[model samples]
Target: MFKYFFVVFCLSLFIRQGLALWCYECVSTQPGCGTQFNWLFHWTKICPETDDVCVKIIEQRSDETIITRSCLSSLRAIRTDIPADHYEGCRPAAKDVHLANYVNNSIKELDIYRNYYDKTTWCFCFLDNWCNSSPSSNAHVYLIIGTSLISLVYMF
Candidate 1:
């Protein structure tokens, strides 16, 4: 009985470690960043330990819109005013942030202009890697866990 418990515990640990949170990282100007986002063209990145959630930023100027996807920590650093309570769902921040910091502090070099922006709405999620993209993003993660459990069961 003790040996069985130890084996189960080890397998559980393995499964947990194999799964890491991933987010769709991209900007509106990039391919697949539009309304009909092409998943194949979108880049998925593992969320850093410091970023516990994925965030989507939508800034609407007079006649243009800008959309950006990144980890919560990244956006928080630039915006700096996201209320701690507004950690999930889509909503406009109480204040509008300037684009100067975002353009200058950006880690990626983009041909698309980011210097122009206005009122912004932010969305945050911790459900799955693509939670920032869609509601059904968690399915694949569940499937992976299911497969791992089956393999472990068959092993013993």
Candidate 2:
């Protein structure tokens, strides 16, 4: 009986991993998923096989703070520039994905690559289903709070 139970448990773990990752897909307006986050039950999407991480982008332009929650595919994630341990906070948009693609495929010039951003656009990529539901920050207090929440939501 114990052996049978162990086999079932192993199978369950494999099944869970086989499923695609899900992220909160919403904009700043609509159901109000902006600076004050609102995690509605329907604000989610199962990511494609190429996309395994959830991403949240908060852009502060002029007088508007646009919050966009989406998914980041592995196409650019495999690039050599983005560090493996960059899943911490809001990363710079240009270096992480945008211009990095051009630099890697076309230019291949690392020296001329400057971190550029119009207004304040913070991009955060995480590896958990529905992880982008919250509006996060770089502060240590927010980091601690986020870690605890992740422990409860994903790690458990």
Please tell me which predicted candidate would have the highest lDDT against the true structure. Answer: 1
The superposed Cα distance between candidate 1 and the true structure at residue 148, in angstroms, equals 7.7
Candidate 1 lDDT over residue span 1-156, tens digit each: 655665578677657754666788889899778545566677677777643788888888897877788887666665644656546788875543543444554555552334345677788887655777755445565775776676667667
- Against the true structure, what is each candidate's TM-score? 0.60, 0.49
Pairs clashing in candidate 1?
none
Which segments of model 2 are wrong by more than 4 Å? 1-18, 74-86, 95-117, 135-156
Would you give me the overall lDDT of model 1? 0.68
In candidate 2, what are the lDDT values of residues 28-139, reduced to their tens digit? Answer: 8766677766554344677776546776666565677777777666324533343344464766454434443444445545434433325444455555556776645224
lDDT of each: 0.68, 0.56
Q: How many angstroms is residue 85 displaced in model 1 relative to the true structure, after the best TM-score fit?
A: 2.4
Q: Model 1, clash count?
A: 0
Clashes of each: 0, 0
